[model samples]
Target: MEAGEHQAVQLCLESGALISTQQHDLSTPVHLACAQGAMDIVRLMFSRQPDQRGASMNATDKEGRTVILLAAARGAWKTVTALLRLDADLSVKDNLRRNLLHHIVLSGGLLDDFHGEINERLKDFGDLLNERDIQGCTAMHYASRNGQLKTIESLLHFGAIVNLKNNENQSPLHFAARYGRYNTVRHLLESKKGHLIINEMDGEGKTPLHIASQNGHTRVVHLLLVKGALLHRDHKGRTPLHYAVTNGFTHTMEQLLAVHSHLLDQSDRDGNTALHLAAMHNKANTASLLLSLSCKISHNEQDFTPIDYALHYKHSEVAMVMVTHPSRSEEVMSCRTKRYTCLVEGLTAVMPEVMMVKHSFQALQNTEGVGDIVPETDQPLPVMNIMVRYGREELLSHPLCVKYLETKWNSYGMYFHMLNLAVYTVFLSFLTTNAVQLMAEKTDRENFTQVTSAQLASAFVYPSTRAKYFLDIMNVLEWTLYISAGLMAAGHLSTAVVDRSNQYIMAALAVFLAWFNYLLYLQRFNRIGLYVVMFLEILSTLLKVMFVFSVLIIAFGLSFHILLAKIDMNVKTPVFDPFTGNVTMRSMNMSDKGFHNPVISLVRVGTMMLGELDFLGTYLRPMRALESSAWYQIVAATWFLVVFIVLMPILLMNLLIGLAVGDIETVRRNAQLKRLTMQVELHTDLERKLPRRILTMVDKTEVYVYPNQKGSSSYVSVPDTKHVFRVHSSYVLRD
Candidate 1:
């Protein structure tokens, strides 16, 4: 049975040897003959075992490969035909439930060779042509996955269903995309049911485009996108764009963006957009590409933006790129109004829009992945502080946003804000008065209690949470109220001298900051707020400037320390020796003391930026003192000061001033709007924290708003002339 030759099988049969129904491996003589495509050996075996023909032909091997099925699958068409003549069971399937066609296609053979009688033999098993494998995949799916284009067409010609789904409900197109078979995918798109299956999703609600994108198959992705494949999300509400961004597939991302740039900003269920994934994955180059394409920096449901993700994940370079990208995207520049239409039934305003657009709405509701968002309009902000905190103040400039600001300001917002500010002033006043008293004052307990109670009540009404407070002013007054209260409490709790000293110091600081914060209250008005807004804008720009110059400052600091740190620069000066009671020349160290510490050295160099050169004290005095030591050291130190002055003070400082001055006009325009946004935020937070019973008791009167309304016009009654010659030229001339 193992030897597949006609003569050997014939000799064995003629000798009257009993024909074994099967071998050890369960392969019979018919199985070996079909496996080798030996039609003569197969016919001899079948004739020799005429009584056992069905048993020999229908028996399966270890892998459950049947005789006739094995022959067809292994391209033994001749032997398959011979087995058919011997009355082989046509309905026999392998253990995998695969039929004759499934075997042939899985063998990766082209069906073009099935001609004449072989073609006739396959047509009788029409149902087998569409029979599914264990995985619910058909022969067409196998052919497509293996890129057997000819075999796919041949199977189609043999009555194969073009859009037949496996148990997985996935079509041949889906299989083709899974393997990145570009040609097969294109052909499937051009097939009879091509359009129907292009966007057809699998059991997981994933489309062929999703599979191709997930695998980073750029060419297949391009073909799918070009074919108008819908940018649908899967059951998880993730789009093809999301899949491509998961692994930083740059080219695939580009293809998806080309077809639907809107998907770039579309968020998944978590509200995370594509850029957030790029940052989280540390795809710096991908982030830069996204920015160049005008992708918006959006916050997800957790209120975290792409930059936040990058910084959190330690992708500093990605954070920098995102932060430096143009704040205004293409969408911002192109913001325009469209003539809106209402989807209503019966062409009447009173008609329920759901009757006309219910199906459309349900489709959107059913769509798991993609959505259209108008964040500034559709998504409501929980608090207004988010705008100023995240530098989203630009949103206040939109026309609709302006209307929201107006409506919010008019509806109890103004009164709430004014009342909140009054409370904050009283709180700051109490903090200041307590701080001014001595640390161990006899009435310290009373003063401390007053301060705490005032702030506690103020916080219950409205907490003055600061956002990006002045960095320089923090040197003296960072969290002044909190620090002062803490020190006062500490002093009251312990009579330690150190605590007492800190109490007085913090007290003095609290008084200064209270005045400063009180001064800022003038910003509540529009005209003064312009200067305050401009100050903050300049301060922000200055922060960026400080960041960029930090490297230069460090470089200069380390160099200054290396060159002059150990130098003995003693200024020779006349001094009185008290012990001897006589005047004498004494050498005094004239070198800058800060050079001993790198931090102090950096501060000294940074101060040069503000025109605090210390030229005479550090450089000139040292040069004079060191003249007697070495002229070379003096020259080097002098030249170093000159270079530092030109770079730090002359160059960057002047440029900063120019930039700050240029911000005036823009500041003037946006200042009022920014203050309004801030005002609304303060009031909103206050109102949200109000007692529920008090809120219930509040007035329910409505405030009507009319946007962009033109001035009303009325006409005066006038007499009309009845006759044609009435009010003729002569009468007009007389008048």
Candidate 2:
């Protein structure tokens, strides 16, 4: 029937092959034919079974549309007229109690084809025109939902109420706007004028504007705006502007915001403004627009900003927009920029997913806490912990991370830092004293025992995850210093005379190495810490530069040895026995420099690279009389000097100097940012040493402290210990 297969449908009816058959929808041949607008096929089926009239023709399928209703909906005019002539129940409603008009309007069909004849058929049936379906949607609702302008117009002309709401309380205009049916929306507004409920909200408290904006229907959104569809917030407290931003419709957002510009910065229930949604969704253009409006860095209830969302979601483009936003620092912030600002607040989600612990990002609110309340292993490792490990400047520089570290620092950080510094200093002092005793050819067994015990305690206290634990350079250095010191002590107790020198050598190694460990603790001061961090960064760059230019330095060094033969050797000394009257072996002095061999020649090149030109006074002061004066040799010597100077000092040295300057410049610009990052790491190391009682205290989960609070600012969580006691000072003690 749908294929206009009149012959096939007629044969099926005549043969009685499918006359008794029904489809999955229980749709018989005639019902299928009517739905497809195959009036001829429907007629043949009816002709074959004349007795199948009233009950058979009026019977509803699964969806409850009768044959006549379906035919009229499909514009099958002849089928509907025949059904009406057979006294078909025009007043009969579907399972949903929708009459013929509902289906006709929903599917866009001519309802008044036989209006003059049908008027008599339903003389007392004017109420059927306004009948409601099971969903309480009238014919007008369906018409608007289907975007049928003609049907909407005809219904309004026939006294159909325009603002009739469905079970969801969604009016005709609501359906029209939701489906982006601008034509019907315009017709409804034009037809009903003031009577049309343009601003009617659905069950979700969303107006047509919200729906249109969410679906990115810019035209429909404009039409609704012009038609007075008020920008309203839904149950989630999201405005139409929120919807526009979420869908990344910049133009639609522009249209909405232009009408009500003040809602641009208004936060919803979650404390998320239009800008937050834009950043979360990586809508760079939308973010740029929001930023252009001087949108401030408003923190959500979770204390996350738009840039936080951008960084957490790995939206670099969005982050760049927010970071470079002209008003980032200039725009007035909420409680953040105040000089007396206090932080009893912060959030967890910070860095991008690729940098996350599990390689997936989830907001703290969405992260399910472990063991009823303790935000333990299940949560993303504490934000500061992640910052220390992952090292995102954006995250580390965030005020929340900074505030957290500051709070920790001001609370008990100084005490913890001083305690550890005192312990390490004692150990260093012991190591130094033992090295000094060995250097003075003395013994101090008590000092040696103390140093060895500290080393053993350190190794034992370290986490058993050795691969990750030992990866720390400090850990490696600690083991080296302690083991060397122990070996030095062992040599002192031995009777072997040759072991004394080995002991001295080992003692020297331990003393100097202990100083390098002090660099790790240098982060306590921001000025020094930032330099240390920058120095590490610059050192990495320096290594690469040196590695690449090593060949040039060696080439020049070897050429120097070949070009100038006079500066050939470091020293020519001989070890001899006077009684034997013979020289045993030649000795080479290492504390001297000249292009004697490849190694010393390369050393000369390295010295020249560092701007140490010894030849200026020794060789070049007065052109030494050449043993074999040749002009070519003179030219070679002069030209090689110039080439080495150009490559090493002028080019390579400046490059190295310029690289350091550039790093210094960057550090200068982001000095505060770098200090904040360093503080986070320092505090992380400090916090890790804290007891579980301290870690658990605060908001019954993670410990938080307000350094500036009037009273005791820490919210301590009483651990689930069997026996616990509180002292007069409110200090908690547990077994």
Candidate 3:
């Protein structure tokens, strides 16, 4: 391993004891000498044998590292010079396809005093100074990437191009910026001829500024910015500020923002600003910084705002910051936004045992005596509806409640009443016309049903007609629309069939309106009458189930009627003639009429299921003579047994009972909510009939403060509608 021991190896080689020694990796004696910077041992190995010199000098190790390449890489100046003098080819490369110059450059800071001589020797090859490896990186790239300032200067002095691009189209400046080499980046930018283009872009259109900003290289970012690196968008339309904010480089972000304040609102290809990126990544401090800069929170192409992203990613802290952002707090409390917030917040399930009742907050009296007495109609406020309903009474009187109460009707709400009125008037007129048509039809009932002239004249002449008309008001309207549309369709397909669904819809509308009219009058006792509505809902479900099961009954009736029809019918049965071996038949008079008609069969099956029929008399005795055949009578009896005993009595009856009992509690618990929902719907429909201008006069402003919380609130005052307040409280509004 030492330079002095080569003489012993020479003596062994001369005596023909051995030619050479090599390790498993194929590293020869010359390779070890060159790797260890033993220039004397390398000379001895070359001179100790004549024919071995060529193989020893040019031999590639397992990794394809030649002696001279290793010598140059290890800064073995004498060994490298000796190998070169002995005709070592500088063109030979390692497995990495790096030539001697590439290796020399890769040897960062290792080549100290011999750097000049090595550089001079490698520079003499001319093109080797700029030779690119397999990845198309020149020696200068390696020097720049490894922070070899002196080597980089030497290479550049030897005519290395400062802006030479690699396979990724990245210049040395990109490598320097990415690795955070502040001195190298400065030197590259301050090249004597200004050869380095400060704004040069890579294949991804990213400049050094973007790279440095992304990597949080503060000093390098400053150097690039001071060198007039223009802010340019990459392939993703992201600028350096976008990179800084996305990567959470606070210092770099501040510097970029300070220099380019206009980028505060710049959006990427996704329409996401730096603030949006910060929020999505849960960079709270960065988001706060951007919020402080008054960055506008705009929606992306997907209609997602920065706050939406924050909530979607479950970044609760970031979402809170965005939702409570000072600039948008008032906007968040606007009518449209507040309505959505309240609806969503109200629906979140809290305690399971809480009864289905609306909840309200009880505001404590403030010093200014501004608190309302929390009237029955005006509990805490609609904003506290969810908190009280879910038993989060602590938050019921929070400041957010005041903010929610500040929400007023949007400008569109001003015209909502007018639109509703127009719709209501149009439908009301249709209903009236339908009623008249129905009355006329009834007066002309001779067309549809037999009627005496005396009765018709009485209908035309007396007040009894009004009583009849009022009695059949809903039915008359529905039938009028139905028959009129049908008659019109019969006259011409295009006449009324074109909007047949519309006609049915109108008929249904009339029916519901009649029902709702009763509900409106019963609003005085809606709490008591809501039970009726819940019952009707349950009854409707039962009816739907009966409708479905009725088909099964019809199916079984038809199938079994046809099946049992031949059970005891008078028909000829085939038999064999014993003498001639030919077919013959015998006729029997059978009189089993139990399943003679499908309707009658259904009746029998129904009676049997109710346990009201004597099985022996009704079913067995009727088919008594057929029992001699055994199989037919047995199958028929078994069919009857399964249907009456198993299917009808046990399976279907229990299933119906279970269905009804399962949802009874659900229906009861949801009764009040459903009633409130229906009442709100009806009131909303009626409210839409008011004039737009009148609605504008009515509580268009959002905020209303009581006498107690007057100075504590920060909402614009709605002076007109302040006297009366409304709470969606279950106890006050319903009970």
Candidate 4:
């Protein structure tokens, strides 16, 4: 029942199972085998049949397609051959009235044996190639539609008609050209009897060239044009150029325009030219090409020109192109400006002021000098709260616009320098303080030192209050710095005790001081802070991958540890010391820390993941000492080197790098907005600190002072004589 199960079919037939059993699709074992191209199963099943005319061999499925017809349609040459040897029906038709030849042609007959076998069967039926289906499509029609060159040649050799038309009145060339089959079109054109149907029209009155041009088949269009296919109009009175322009096929339009330049002005049933169609569809390149060929811009039946069509569809770029052509017709230019001036007025933010108000008022000379005279109208240019922000290059190149230099605000005053100095001084002081203490500890052992007194005192005074503010990372860091400063003070104050605990406390204090100072420095660059935040966001994903990687390492490390546990050899290991000489000790492995235990193996593998592969000596020394298990240890070490070193670290590390690189641009764009947010916060803080009198004196400033009344209905404050600088409202563009 399954595909390629010839043995199962043989076993069932030899055991005398029913040959006429049907599946849910109403297909028998023969139909199923033929569909799968199971030639052996087909032969086995047909050989067990009771007779040639039995119900199973010549049975039609639900769709009325028999076994051999299904095989022929699927191009199953072996299955078709096996059925033909058993005398299968060759003249049966399906629900679509398609015989064996029709199915072969429709399936393209790509296989040689399949097409040849079907063609040999058709020779006994006498001119089945020209026989009509239900839709009146012959085998040649299907061959042409599917671009089956071999099938076409076979049908032609069998005396198939070349100029047969389907029910849609479309010739083989129409179907070939419409589907962009360049080779099939060429083969049809090269045929002696098929060359005359080049311009034959279908039901829609579209020629092969029209269909090819509409589909944007450049090579087929060129070939059709070279073969004398004309650019005739269809039922809608639209030429091939109209179709090309509407579809934005610039190359096809170029080829057609070279021969038929007058088709540029040809109008359709609605009196819309090719330019109108292109503009309405927002085909800027096609519209520009039409304008370059001097296509006339005229109105449609509704008195709408191409520019109006573009504006009606909100295609501003296309409208701008149509309005700026250098060689545009005088009639088009004269009528376009007044008709679509609303579009130019809508671009007030992007266009220059001179062009925006050019036609509104003319210059008049008063008693003083020439100036703009105001004109009265019922509806002035609507106030634009939102406008298109065109780039500088686009505004500079507009024909009716003149560019003006915009004044830019630069933050280079004393306030900017003071903010920078504050951040830099704090960062440098933290580093300098740590360095000075380190030098004093090394050079002067008798004297004690504390870096800063204020930091030392605040550390012991604010432990409880600082613990309450741990949710804020900055607060937590500040408290950590304070506590670390207190710990360092304690260490220096207790130097006389000379305890080892003091050394450990000093080490932890050093780490906290360095981390707190680094965070302080990062807060200064708000833009870089955004990059840090983005990197932190992907930390969870990296940790998850590391979790999986660790699981794998742990599994493999335990395996290697258990396998190489008893293979260690005692050797002398040297210990490096400053006060004493290098001492040697007898150890079972490198550093007396043999990886015979799983925990030690895991630690070694963890270091190897960070590209520390010095454990090769640990594995090699054990192999050299134990000659019995030397080969197994070498294999285990090699596997460790391959998987943990090459596979995990290199490949997974690169994957993380790729993920970080992909998010870099997104982080950079967001950093700009974050920088602006920081600037707004800094400016607000500065405003709150300044005196009210000085804040009132600032230009483009707004002030809202609530009245000091209690339970009064009218609590709005009015400007009194004492605070005389109050204004209603003003706008300030943040620097």
Identify the leading candidate in terms of lDDT. Answer: 1
Instruction: Rank candidates by TM-score, best first.
Output: 4, 3, 1, 2
Selected candidate, larger lDDT, 1 vs 4:
1
TM-scores, all models, native as reference: 0.42, 0.42, 0.45, 0.53
lDDT of 2 at 272: 95
> What is the clash count of model 4?
0
Write model 3 residue lDDT over 498-569, tens digit each, in one string. Answer: 344454454455445534543433322324455666666676677888787776567656655765655653
- Candidate ordering by lDDT (highest first): 1, 2, 4, 3
Candidate achieving higher TM-score, 1 or 4: 4
RMSD of 4: 17.0
Model 4 scores worst on lDDT over the 10 consecutive residues at 400-409
Clashing pairs in 1: none
Sliding window of 10 residues with minimal summed lDDT for model 3:
350-359
| Model 1 Cα lDDT, one tens digit per residue, 1-735 | 566656777888898854545678888766777789877766676677777776776779887878888887778776766666666676778888887778778777656655554456665667677778898988888999999988877777777887889888899999999899999999889988889999999999999999999889999999988888888888878899888888778899888888788888888889888888888888767787887887777778887766556545556455434433454323321322121132111112332211111111122123232223323332223334445545676654533344445444545555775786788788887776666566435545776677777766655565434453334353235355555656665566566733666767766766776676666656654456557766776778889988988888998888777666777745666878899999998665524357767788887777767877767766677676565556566567778878888888888788888877876767556665666666655445555566657544642323222211234111111112122111111111211
Candidate 3 deviant stretches above 4 angstroms:
1-11, 15-22, 75-78, 85-87, 109-124, 192-196, 324-735
Per-residue alpha-carbon lDDT of candidate 2 for residues 224-278, written as tens digits (9 for 90 to 100): 7777776667899999999889988888888887788888898899999888899
Candidate 4, residues 1-735, lDDT tens digits: the string is 775677777788888877678778788887877888987666677677666336777788888889888888887867777777667777788898888888876765643555455456666544566678888888877787788888777667667777788888878888889888898888888887656889888888899999988889888999998988877789998899888888899999999888777888999989999998998899988988888887776778888888677656667556555555556633444554335464344333333221212211111101122112212221111011001112232322221111010000012212442454454345335534553554455422222243454344333331333233568565576666655544554555556643435645664665556554554445324344555545554565577777877777787677656656555566555666767766656566433444567799888667666777765465656666666656576667667666766665788678767766767766554443333333333333344444557544542212222222223221111113233221111111011
Choose 2 or 4, whichever is better by lDDT. Answer: 2
TM-score of 1: 0.42
- CA lDDT of each prediction against the hidden true structure: 0.67, 0.65, 0.60, 0.61
Clashes of 1: 0
Q: After superposition, how far is residue 9 of candidate 4 from its true place, in Å?
A: 4.5
